[model samples]
Target: MRVALELVKEGRAEACVSAGNTGALMGLAKLLLKPLEGIERPALVTVLPHQHKGKTVVLDLGANVDCDSTMLVQFAVMGAVLAEEVVGDQKSPGGVAQYRGRRNQRPRQYS
Candidate 1:
């Protein structure tokens, strides 16, 4: 992770993609890349096979086992940002579009 981020930061690489341990990736990515300005937590996203049309992207897949609504919202934001970044447009699904941030309202009290 450090090496990948270093490459990007040093102008050796334009972008980076890694697939490994989720917890490890999150820890290392946070350490190297830091969170986006408005993003509270970085999300790990994947496109799954859908029965219908296009695939669905789910973020933060078990990254933080313990739950927080705000964090979930941030995941959606990050995931959408990722999609748009990849396709080079943040308009609509015709290419790639701004995603609806799927965040919950607040923290929940559990007993």
Candidate 2:
């Protein structure tokens, strides 16, 4: 994992995709590639198919066991950008939901 990440860090590779230990991948990515400015912690984002159409951008995926409000907002912004630029979606997703336990069904709004 470190070797793959090192290649990206040295510019020998553009990106490193891993299906290994999530914790180890996140840790090494932070150590080698570093997070972007204003990003408290890098998010592990992926695309998932929407039930009706298009796709959904999901993030965090155990990258951070807990996150403050600011971190949540950052993840939302990053997800939106990836959806727009990468996924080529003009409109944003339906909403951003905060997962807590299993009964929280409300979407989180940041002021």
Model-by-model lDDT, in order?
0.62, 0.77
- lDDT string, candidate 1, 9-55, tens digits: 67799766876666776777677776778776666666666687545
**Model 1, clash count?**
1
RMSD after Cα superposition, model 1: 7.2
Least well predicted 10-residue stretch by lDDT in candidate 2: 97-106
Enumerate residue pairs that collide in model 1: 73-103
Clashes of 2: 0
Best by lDDT: 2
TM-score of each: 0.60, 0.72
State the TM-score for model 2: 0.72
Give the per-residue lDDT digits (tens) of candidate 2, residues 42-70.
78888999898888888776677667778
